[model samples]
Target: MARVALKGVRKDFGQTKVIHGVDLEVADGELVVIVGPSGCGKSTLLRMVAGLETVSAGEIAIDGRVVNQLEPKDRDIAMVFQNYALYPHMSVYDNMAYGLRNRGMAKDEIDRRVREAAKILELAALLERKPRQLSGGQRQRVAMGRAIVREPKAFLFDEPLSNLDAKLRVQMRVEIKKLQRQLGVTSLYVTHDQVEAMTLADRLVVMHAGIAEQIGTPLDLYARPASTFVGGFIGSPAMNFLPGHAENGTVEIGHGVSFALPGQAARGDVTVGIRPEHMTLNHGAGMATLPLKVDLLEPLGAETLVYGKLPDGLEVTARVHGETQVAIGSTLPFSVEPRHVHLFDKASGKRLP
Candidate 1:
């Protein structure tokens, strides 16, 4: 395993820049995920690292060696793509050994590697089956097995589980995590799915408009988002944002409701961010408590989601531990997690203390 670093990396397509001077570091044996919306340059960045696309500018180092101009093969990395990309006629064993054979390894050595990888992937029984004979998850494992046989320095996955069904995707996620840990391989996984990134990454790199919004452990990003975009993007059902002001050592949310600031702030407009899970129904008078009406309720067994609008007409969401019985048109009092509230500069959308 090796540490990978990107220094001032940028990519451009003519006059339009897709990636703008991004720097990242992946520690040895770490499993990092790069995630963002489609066309946000996440895939382009991965391609640059794979030598499939030029860097346009900057340096990329793997294992302390500059690989700016190195070939993909010379980079010593294996990539599993969204599609299985398997040879239809090749048996599972042959698929896994194809790379080793191409490198002119001895036949016995190829057999040993293929057999070992098949066992790890639990594909030994299906080794004789062709690509079409296996299920979607099985084919994806074959793709991973192909990468494992060569014992590359690192592994790269490009939405490898996107083709599987929802249930299968969850199962493969655990499998991939276990396989990576077992091999102790440094990995970079890219996907548009937030759930995949949250469940699989040791560190999650959230990207937006060609820039990395934030990078941290899954819980770190969730608890302390670097910006408003990150706070809203990292959680399920997303965080709710309300326009307000920060002045007089207090934050005024809406309809005359004000809460004392955790720290000093500038006297100007700001955005308040509170996650659905960080909100609670309140019946007592409390600072920052706002009068809200429940517009809808979604029962989720363990918890319930409330969709409603604040008095000032901004969308808001709240989740309760048990299935809430609040009805539409019912007035309810609610408050945010005191320390969990996030403030952002309304003009820049950047986080504020």
Candidate 2:
């Protein structure tokens, strides 16, 4: 395993810049996930690290060695792509051994690596099966097995599980996490799904446009988002934003509700952010309360999601325990803890200090 570093990395297609000066470090044996909406350059960034794409500017280092001009095969990294680029005519065993064979390893050494990879992937029993005969998850494991056989300095995954069904995706997520830890290999994974990024990453890089908006542990990003884009993108049932003004140590949200600033003092127009899960039906006298008109209720067995609007017509969402009983069209009181409320500058959409 080795540390991966990107210093002011960038990519451009003619005059169009896709990756704009991203600097990041992945510790040896760390699994870092790059997540963002499509066209945010997450995939392009991963490809640059793999040496599959040219670095338009800046440096990419693996194990402290600059690899900007190395070929994909010479970079000592293996990439498992979204399409599971397997040989259709080859059996699982051959698929995993092809890379080693191409490197001119001894036949016995190739066989040994192939068998060990198959065992690690639980594909030993399916070694004779061709790509068409394997299930989606099994084929993805075969893709991973191919990477594992190389014993590369790092592993890169590009939406490797996107082809699976929802249930299979969840199962493979656990498998990938366990496999990465067991191998202790440095890894960089890219995905558009925030849920997958949250569940799998030791750390996350949230990208927007062509820039890395934030990079931190999942909980850190969730609790203290660096900007409004991160707060809205990292959490499910996205954080609710209310247009309001901050002045005189108080934030005046619509409906005449105001919250006292608990720490830093900022005055001017601001966007207030509160996660759905942080809003509750219970409130104390000091807390700010807002009246919500319930529009719909979605019960997911384990929890229920309430969709509603405030008196000022700002839409909001609240998550509650599954046992809570509520009806549509009813008025309910909702409150958020003072510390849970986030304020962002209205003009810049950046978190306020």
Candidate 3:
């Protein structure tokens, strides 16, 4: 319902600075997810936008109006916390209607909004249940429904699905995506889970050490990371880093293994990054090949993960098809395409252009 913008946002506590000059904008009706590891200032940033935390510097605007001094209630935003924050004594219906009642809305209008939210969240029959009578997913839905009934200008979610089981988290993820799309509400979500962030976000803000490492669509960041940190953090199983010496058109690493650097001219000490999913057990003609001494194998039903070390004792991981058979302590050949290889500066850890 509103466009949210952050211009040079910075937060500090006494002498320590947590957020450092973050600039971001969320278009109206877009779902943007801010994802990072623990202690990365993601939740703190979200709290600042929700008016729960004061901004030490910089301006936060919602719907083209600066809300630097506005109270949480006056900001016209709804927040769904991680813990659900539901009352044990109130029924689901009363829980959803409590905010409206406090705002002096008519009883009939409160009922209409509450019922509409319940129907949308598939909680119509559970309206009479108390918080203790519901499951974790149900409680989460109640928390979301409470936020939806308010029809606020924007929604802020702080790791709302952290408490659910894996299956429930998957189910709730689909539900949340569908709900946000149906309502067309602008939302900003914070999560430490990279997979969850990749699945739910239209655009993702990857944060590190109180700074945004990269902000782009999930595919963009996955295909080409801006730095070594973003490259290692955004993917599952993480990207493998090999210290190599950059030559005129190639980087040599680990016991004479050299990969062709196409279209790059950075020649010096560099780090070569290759994703696990891109490593293939089958070697093709004219492809770069590395011999790996397999140390471990994890057969996940759909695919197998092979963990091994290169000739120079550098660790590497490869994802192979489910039917592939491999033995520990055996030497297996792995191939990688030249284009899938990523080059980064060894000194600064920044990706090479």
lDDT of 3 by residue, 1-353 (tens): 99999999999989999999789999999999999999999999999999999999999999999998999999999999899999889999999999889899999999999999999989999999999999999999999999999999999999999999999999999999999999999999999999999999999999998899999999999999999999999998899988989878887885767887677798989999999999997676667788989999999989999999998899999998989989999998898988899999999899998
Sort by TM-score, best first.
Answer: 2, 3, 1
Q: Candidates sorted by lDDT, descending order?
A: 2, 3, 1
Compared with the true structure, what per-residue lDDT tens digits does model 2 show for residues 1-353? 89999999999999999999999999999999999999999999999999889999999999999999899999899999999999999999999999998899999999999899988889999999999999999999999999999999999999998999999999999999999999999999999999999999999999999899999999999999989999999999999999989988789997689987766588889999999999998887578887889999999999999999998788899998899998999988888888899999999999997
- lDDT string for model 1 (1-353, tens) is 89989998999999999999889999999999999999889988888888888898999999999898998888988889899899999999888888888889999999998999999999999999999999999999999999999898888899999999999999999999999999999999999999999999999999999899999999999988889988888989899888878897788876788877656556799988888887877533344676678898888889988888877778788888775678888877887645777888899898886
Error of 3 at 111 (Å): 0.7
What is the lDDT for 49 in model 1? 86
CA deviation > 4 Å runs, candidate 2: none
RMSD of candidate 3 to true structure, Å: 1.0
**Each candidate: what lDDT?**
0.88, 0.94, 0.93
Question: Which of candidates 1 and 3 reaches a greater TM-score?
Answer: 3
Per-residue lDDT, model 3, residue 7, is 92
